[model samples]
Target: MRLHPVVSLALTGLVALATGARAESWNSVTVSWTAPGDDGMTGVASAFDLRYSTSPITAASFGSATRWTSTPAPAAPGTTQSVTVTGLLPSTTYYFAIETADEVPNWSSISNVVSRTTSPMPDAVRPAPLTVAVTSVTDSSASLGWTAVGDDSLNGTVSSYDIRYSTSPITATSWSGATQVTGEPLPAAPGTPQSCTVRGLSREVTYFFAARAVDDAGNLSALSNVPSVTTLDSMPPGPITNLSVGFVWLGWHSSLAIRPRSAEARGR
Candidate 1:
């Protein structure tokens, strides 16, 4: 016995109502639905049509709304099927639905609709300036230290630091010529002092050093106060040993001669 047209239509509506969607992030959603029965009464669904909109989703609204199709189609009947939808706006609500179609090309009504709001995007801002100083000095290098700065409004974490130095006195207006020092490790955590050594400098030269903080988003802070440090001078050579002074008369002039003990024996 064949069922009436009205009965078959009612069953198809029930199957379509089983579909649902979930918001995964600021730009994505996951759609899922229960498989419909394989029997001709409800028909065998060979594929799924997914649609989304900022407004309430209906069969008519789907025409101009964003659309996506299920690839490889849904599995055999009674299996839970799902598909992820992406590129949606964040912090906004979106409505989604799924429509099933049989091999005979008969399309079912729109499935149950669901809505979700995505998370907001991160804030992009620069961090505050850091305080720097020279802690130690050597013949050809200097060790520097500074206090770490917090991220912009604490929206992000501190990443690293940029150290710069110059032989001339460093000031906010004259820092462009300051050479950047490399091979310095990332600064310590916020509220702590970070240290690094600058090498390959000229001995006995006075240098001005400064530093800046960087956040994870690549934001750079203002330059810190410049501290001046002078490298140590070179050591002096040893003095000669066993020296002697003698006076000699040549006519009306008297001359004094200096000689080493080892040279006196050779001269004799």
Candidate 2:
């Protein structure tokens, strides 16, 4: 209640910088990956992962490198570990680093060693596997067609086709409301011929069709495995009789079989 020793040491150094950013240190030490550069483009995030340096200072002098795992792993607060360091040693000059356990040791400030020089793994041009076909199905409409995309590896053309559906056979991670067919680059070799006919839909209902082919820098080919359709009842219902009711002694006691020859005409 009296005196300023330099204003109480500047309020005790602002309460030790807000308690050291809240007792920082979530510890995992090492377990991360990053190698961004795929250029497939569809949502383009190019994955990432590769760390072994910069922490509280200890462990990892440098010995192992090359780890990227994201077959279907990358979605959450978003950063569920990544690894894609394939055979790296081409031009030798590596010194990668990127640590982040979401919050531990509070690491995420050492990504400036991106000096890459490995070029000899770019012969993986896959773009030929989209031959879907349903042709027709009426009840509300649906006539999708596809058979184009014949290995356009470098010529690079295709550009559109990703129509998925699911009435519940399971295998649709969420398309929100998928139905996008736009492929028309043909001249033979399964490269030119596309069609679409999807309307209202809902009569006898029972649908499931599939298609996939996107190459113009969208790169998405591995989802043409759910072809099915059953929608045609526009007006079908005419054939069902025999109501029955006594009807001639139930149709002659079920086609007659009750005979005793009337015991000689029942004793005359």
Candidate 3:
């Protein structure tokens, strides 16, 4: 005997976006279901309404649950459908349910609720400390280079770089007080080389710099080994300004002498 009246709403790894998501990069959780006929699955359903939440989803609370609009159009009865819910925190569980309607706008009962939990730190790992070094320096700027590290120990590119510098050494305890560099280069693939130039530094001063990586899941990496460089001394002394001569003599002698220059001389 074969019977398919349409009643299968559940969570399957496969994903398709309803309207909003970053599925292209996230390859994460998705909801799968067979169109329900409680309202009208034997006939072509007009639309689908998918909703989800952090807690258990039920018929009584369906109205307040978050709705995922722009859901895919329903196929004939028994055809499976799915959607990828995006922008969720790591290590958290989510509940989902769906309903359908006919051309007359008669909606079906909320399907069975399904649940999924996002992965926390992928593989329970953190990125290795990045290796950064000051490559060059001038009177007012310094260039740095480092080998890029992955989000989870060289597995995936990190989401961002936390680069900072200070007159003293940079460390986890003092990271917040260090001056954060603006326009840090975006993270590259693990083992790839990356660099950035920090400008507007004071001449003849030494600066210690460090960096760390952050993953999309919000996990932070260890602080990098600190490297430092002293900027070149200020530009050569300006052209000689006061060059007049001076002489010390007894009052008895009537002799004309040049006055010693006491203050910086201006271009005359």
Candidate 4:
């Protein structure tokens, strides 16, 4: 007796979960399909084939399309099977289909075609070098300026900057101990000079400052070179108060003597 072919193929779900993508990545999708029936014939499906491609998927496209593992037949007809497809290009649309075959080697027609686009990949590149300089200093604060760096090939714009300072040298490894400078503009424009003032500093104390750039995707760059600046002392000097002045005429030819005394001085 001639074996019957799968008469009905349908897709049950195409849930695209974000659980598999790693940091700064979006290149995965999950697909599910309902097993087709044997049209009341006496044959049962032995396996299911899943295929995908960037273009419309057809029976002829199976040879060129990316094929997933051949899943074993479901316990019974009309059952559902699911598979998670990964490592696909981000921000790209893909077409998918399913094919069922029975023990008689008769393949069913391709299932309903479905298409889905992966989420855009997150920005993974770090920003270029950021040069920080101490533009102005005072007894209680230090004004900072920096030449902003551009994003990696401008793929993503710079979101903001993380300003850090410490009494000791500032480095990438010691960033935790450094104090963060807040209130600065978030998402400073790329390739621009940004400035900010850090307050509450100690008088006559030296501080090391550094900075790093953060992209829109929250990827941070390496720490900038440590630039040191010493705050002005601005302390008042000791006061000097004294008065002592005496002048005696040395011209004795006419027997004349003169004395005058009046002296005042102040020190700060």
Candidate 5:
């Protein structure tokens, strides 16, 4: 179609401006950091596209890139925020990218790529040390009492206490088979007690006692130190004393069934 020169130029200019406006122009740049632990920190990037990879990177190449649309926005740029990623493989290295998405461009360039390795978790903490006291003791059994341990995770809140006992002494290794005597529940108020008597132990046999605190999350504290006690052992009556020979003979004469004999004869 034939058109005037001004008209053609005006159309071209409009197209160019539209294309440029759609492509680049968001130039705000910022960086922030976060520490998962004492070991490392993560940089929260802004105004830049981020791509992460376990291996060395090249332009626009990321082993894994932050899915900004799906992932939550990183905290304010140039600031560090602490976060712990749970269920991460132990001792594995992970790479991350921080980037900004400019409305003008199809995809923005990544600003900085930071990599960090997760720490290996230690064995779960043993139930906190607790004191289980014996309130009463009988010839055959004893009554025990205990208080719950404070959970540090919940700001010193306690969820429950596991009351364990064994006729044998309680040790970390030996307590595996110990009977769980009581499970004292800690309501929101907390500070509830657990008391129960243990029976079926042999007289004079020492039994050990211990308790463990379990938070609502099922984290168990270390087993407390073993406390032990022995059952009562009552002695038998004393032996008979010496008596007159005449009285003994008279008693024997009166009742043949009740007759008494000399020690040597009886022994023979």
Candidate 6:
């Protein structure tokens, strides 16, 4: 069988697969068969005809199918023969067949057909990174807003959000180490305005925040834009009143207190 290099194929980056659509992949499959001879399994064949098609491939239909390229030369008659075909479509079924020829240009009959269905592609694309901003803040909590995005870059609604905050600036690399805010709402439709509030933060503390989006396929987007805010300082040093300066009579005493401040929450 003589395999040609010319084959047809198409490529597309479909991160947001439509409902019920088959997933696509970038992969290949191999086909193998025992070698046939130049003259009835007696001698090495001079050339090979290797072809594949989406439909059943037969002796008559082989010429119209896509031929595999650079097939290895036949071995001694009755030896093993194999070929790895590439550029095949993902999540597709294909049929392959072959014929053998001799130095006399005499061609043998096509071999029995073989069929294989490729695996569906994996979802490796991450959601669009969010660009979050502060919307409101109180002594113990804060609200955040950002343009909503989907599972893929502006492709479809994501499955969830991982909102995190820290006194230090947050980043994609540091996302896992930051404090995660719970009760995040399900992601909104792509391009919709979205908002969420983080609770249990300390008053009068500065906090830095960032977020990541997750897909049903478990794909995670990079961290969103980091934003910072200080919670309302409504608790501390509430107006000391009644200034009474008595003469240095009996023992006079005074006291004070302190605590580490936590920043308000921020996220996508």
TM-scores, all candidates, are 0.49, 0.25, 0.49, 0.71, 0.41, 0.63
> On a 0 to 1 TM-score scale, where does candidate 5 land against the true structure?
0.41
For every candidate in turn, the CA RMSD to the true structure comes to: 14.7, 24.0, 16.8, 11.4, 20.4, 19.1
Task: For each of the candidates, give the backbone clash count.
Answer: 0, 18, 0, 1, 13, 8
Candidate 6: tens digits of C-alpha lDDT, residues 1-268: 5432211122222232323444443345577767666666666778877888999976678899997877888787666666667676778887877777788787766777777777666677889998999999999999999888878778989999989999888876777789999998888899988889999999889999898898888888887889999999885666868878777658756676776555553331
- Across residues 1-268, which tens digit of lDDT does each residue of candidate 1 receive? 3221110111111011111242224566665666764343454466667778899887788677787754347566666666666666767787877666666555666777787666664334678887777899999999988767788834345787788899998777877788999997866657776788999999989999988778765667877888999999877878989799999977775598886678768899
Q: What is the C-alpha lDDT of each candidate?
A: 0.69, 0.45, 0.78, 0.74, 0.50, 0.76
Model 6 clash pairs?
A: 1-48, 1-49, 1-99, 2-48, 2-49, 24-121, 150-156, 206-263
Q: Per-residue lDDT for 25-90 in model 2, tens only?
A: 122122233322222111223223344323221125322443334333323322334333333433
Q: How would the candidate models be sorted by lDDT, starting from the highest?
A: 3, 6, 4, 1, 5, 2
Give candidate 1's whole-model lDDT: 0.69
Better of 3 and 5 by lDDT: 3
CA RMSD (A), model 6:
19.1
lDDT of 2 at 225: 62
How well is each residue in 1-268 modelled by candidate 4, as lDDT tens digits? 5444453434443344444243433576677766655543444567777888999987778668888774455446656667777778888898888777776667777777788877786656788767888899999999988866777734446777889899999877899889999887665556667798999999999999988888766667888888999999899998878767999877546767876544543331
lDDT of 5 by residue, 1-268 (tens): 2111100000000011112213211221122333121111223222333343446444446535433233334343334432222333445565655434322322333434555554443323344556678887767877877655566532466667677778777777877789886434452323446676777667877888887777654667777767788888866778778754653434334444666899999999
Off by over 4 Å in 4: 1-25, 35-44, 59-64, 70-79, 153-157, 186-191, 237-268
